[model samples]
Target: MIYKVPFVEPTKNYRMIKNEIDAAFFEVLSKGDLIMRGQLKQFEENLAKFVGTKYAVGLNSGYDALHISMLAAGVKNGDEVIVPAHTFVATASAVVNAGGTPVLVDVGKDYNIDVTKIEEAITPKTKAIIPVHLNGRVSDMGAIMTIADKYNLVVVEDACQSLGGTFNGKRGGAFGMAGCWSFYPFKILGGYGDGGAITTNDSRVAKMARLLRYNGEDRETGEYYYHGFTCLLDNLQAAFLDIKLRHLPDWIKRRRKIAALYKEGLEDIEELKLPHFDTPGFEDVYQNYVIRTSKRDELANYLKKNGVEILIHWPKPYYSYKALELKDRGFPETEAICREVLSLPMNVEINDKQVEYVIKTVRSFFK
Candidate 1:
């Protein structure tokens, strides 16, 4: 039997909510309330409330969220900010753009920073740690925060993939000094276009970020604060995000249900390493439903031939690239996982039958 499953179909998700989206789309444009208007303010307020933070500054993209958050939290030129090597290059890019050197770290099987090894990597020049919450699972914030407190380092969470995720009863963005989120169309709380936000309880950090996102001009006083970048989240996009935000809780529930199905179907395969299940005190939102296997390349090929679309998060670690020139970085676990990690289709649009077909097809390959 032939089966068709792409990684994620954002169109399908959009179709399901077209009316609400159209209503929001038309409402924003008709009013000509573009650029940091009511919609943006509403979305920011709503996002902050949802993430349990005192502030949420909407930005053009997640990279800006990370970069602005770092600068706001005092990451300076030549300072070292630790990050897991396994995540998207944007995490490291944020560090570089903030004028800090990215100190790459390794990751565990859960696809998050290896908390046990973080302290060993700390240095006197280390100013912060950006524990990327990869694959919709939060890192061990307890360990991360402990290390940060010990070193007096800032904790800027790359919570892009873990919007609805939690660790130890705390939401993804809430655990850090500032948490950065992405609203790319693929994210759980995705928007129609590029959108992102920074969540923070620290009012000063929040204020600084707000200033930096615009031209460093204090809107209230019409005074220039500092030279900043033009990277504000679109008001229309914010309106759309506000609509999607209302549906996020239900979407997260469906995502978790999908994760459960994946775990039940694939856990028996000794060669395949699944992500963590309902470990106590963690509520993973299952952003991509990743699995690791030594036979990743072979399996990926077989799945593609049989029409089960798959993806590798990063074919190689960021530090492996020549442009960055950090080949000396020792991320043993990251080096190992680069050859094995695979992301299965884990979007809300996927039906149970599609998941079953994927599972059955994967089993066929192993046999």
Candidate 2:
């Protein structure tokens, strides 16, 4: 059964830029430079300029970005890296992939890492902190940065969900030692296929990340510097991303408009908790217009049955995963949020009629 409003529609977005994308494809095809060449270099430069970073290295996927960031940050076996317990598993798995132990911490009301709890979790072995900017909302980087400075810990930002989000007028990827981003089709700044990047002001970290993403080889000489993974972003995907980047500002503005509409329609419902779009010192891109309800499962079922497609950002917290060996360790806030949060149909392609239908359907369920 097809739903009236799908959670995301990358194909519709692709169609909007098909001509430009086709042109880019042919240009790259004509050049016959498939790997990291002109298109990838230009994309990296444009992305670095956009995010206010000194360097940006493109990779195959966001997981590679995070994993490469950890390696570049000097995270080694037996070292501990703090990560939010409520995020996508990749946030924590990156630590393990880099040979560091992931120390989980619960998130706060804003659905970001609770900086207050960060200090207690730090130890002699703690080498880094990976703060996930979940739902296109920048985490409290002001506090997280302070803590990192105090502990001399590396801060690798997971800005995959928050390409344009800003805090205190600073871009999401600008505050950390290295920022990892994703171009998964579902993300705010999506690509046609798997793509990712790491941004940083530190030249040393930038160099390491570049090497890590490209088999640790010297780009100019093609000499192997160290053992590394083959994780370069496709030149064609970079071209697609380059075109999409031009419209990101408008896309973010539209997402904010949709969030405003959601709040206007749902704010009065006592049982539902809407996202804090107007948080001081922060500008959210509304990557996923998530709302919380006590009757989450029932409401989701009702919406699905009625032709409105909805989803859960995550049905389980990171700590609850058996592979993490953290069951019963109790992250109450994370657990509660996992059970209640629901992501509505959010994307640039969603029309006003679809938005209103979602609103009406949600209100009908509560009534």
Candidate 3:
């Protein structure tokens, strides 16, 4: 029996990049400025330009980015920050780390924060709202912003999985006051390893983030003034990210095309519920093509047995985590989606043959 191909493969440019990375390493070695050098400046500037933001502060991880952004947003002790119940724990944990309480809200059908319910959670103590763009799908920023304006709350967009996504002509990270991004290996615009950035046009917030990431040092004085985490990004990883950033547009296009193929193949299948693409004028980038089905475990096991690798984007939502466990949490839609959402093979490197195999395998499982 012939087994199906592997699910996803990264666009590894070793042949073209191994030498360049080596050169960068040697250059950094020669300069003896491996920590925060000119390369970091260039990477930060280039990233800001790409995201249409005035500044981009590189950090050790996306969680640090969110934590710093929360600090910049003034989410302090006992303040309530609303977050979607369906997102990764990092989004809520950042709020908690910043000494704020994260009130988990239910999501709508689009797998994003339920903007309709966000207003209901706002109180005098509510300071910020973290709208996570789960699976590269843009959240309803327009309505979210409207609600935020009415209540005087900050909108911190969790754009970790939406590096190349766009909403209403504006980039994903440029919508809110401050946007946090991740460069994890599996993300759309991933780096060599764990990395993250906070994008913002606000000069004050940008400066605070820069200082916050480096032990609150005064760049000019070169003196440690206040306490902050040592989350400065590695220059070597930034170099690799710069190279990958050049080809991100083409990769995004291919991912969108592949998503179209999946829609065409699975739209009529009664066993699965394909994600909705109702947000027009937004380039989603398709980070992970997730589908919901009642027979999720059976389908995943069947595909795995057939060599068609599949995964659940998240088996447990943020509220289910022990640390973030909420009291009397009730979200039927989130629980249902969590139990059923399955991610198929989706990447720029995926070929048409692989797409066909995935469709065939999924169909056979349902049949």
Candidate 4:
């Protein structure tokens, strides 16, 4: 069932950078430094500079970044952390992993946490808010920050999908107290394997995150300070990521170009709702070019039958999962979006031919 146009193709991107990646692999192996070493340090430094942050701590995965950020932000047991119900489960699961209660809140039309709804969900137990910058779009950070200032709540941005996105000239990971990122192969700035980072201006939080990624040991002396987890990003992965990081600006530009093409080609369809691209003060990287339609199921089936592959970002809201014990609560917008949103083929390597083919196929569906 190989589709003519697949949802995402990481191999295409890999092939483009194969030579550099191979050289990076050889360099790391030749040096025999596969752990907390030079490559990882260089990657951390480059990432911090890229994100406009004072520090960035590399970890094994974005989940570890979120969990460690919560711990460092002082989200203790029984404390509540407000999170969007529309995001991936990892956003809320990270709070739970940090011994904090995840308080689910509904999202707005842009598929991000509704800042207007955040305050109502806050209680005396509220400790922080984790705003997920979904699908490369930056959330309302200015408003969210103002709310945080009023409530004295910590903000940890889940910026995994927004590596190159910006809000009012500020980068995605630089808005909150700490920002978490994922390099899970499919992301905008992906790595060869699982990798993540935490960015922050607070020296204390950055120091704690650095300690928590490893087994809480002094890097220079290798002395144990406290119990931690084995969440360090491998040096080989860091090497690959460093190479990818250099090409990120160009890649992001390509993605934006593709997104604009989609918008222009599909905007005329009365049954479809396009992603918000013209929001003032926000610059998106188009990590996933998503659209909404009432005939979502029919459209997906039609595209599959016609040799095009698509995906739903999430088929259900995060809170609907039984493990969270939140089935009773309702998120009307999140639930509605779960049934309507569809992710078309979006990647740096996606060409105009493929984009036009998808747009033609989609227009045919309505006809």
**Candidate 4 C-alpha error for residue 47, in Å:** 0.7
- Compute each candidate's TM-score over C-alphas: 0.97, 0.97, 0.94, 0.98
Q: Evaluate all candidate structures by whole-model CA lDDT and list the values in order.
A: 0.89, 0.90, 0.84, 0.90
By TM-score, the better pick of 2 and 3 is 2
RMSD of 4: 1.1
Encode model 4's per-residue lDDT on 193-253: one tens digit a residue.
8999999999998888877777897787888876888898898899899999999999988
Model 1 lDDT per residue over 1-367, tens place: 3449988787899899999999988988899999999999999999999999999999999999998988887888879999888889999988888788988888876778988888888989999999999889989898889889999998999999999888888899998889999999899888888999999999988888889889999999999998998999999999999999999999999998888898899889888988875457788998988888999999999998988889898788778788885534678788888888888889889999999999998898888
lDDT of 2 at 213: 76
Model 3 lDDT tens row, 174-258: 8888989898888887877899999999998888888888889988899875598889888877877777787788878888899
For model 3, the local distance difference test gives: 0.84
lDDT of 2 by residue, 25-67 (tens): 9999998979988888899999999999999989999899999
Model 4 alpha-carbon miss at residue 120, Å: 0.5
Q: Report the CA-based lDDT of candidate 2 relative to the real structure.
A: 0.90
Off by over 4 Å in 3: 1-4, 10-33
Better of 2 and 3 by lDDT: 2
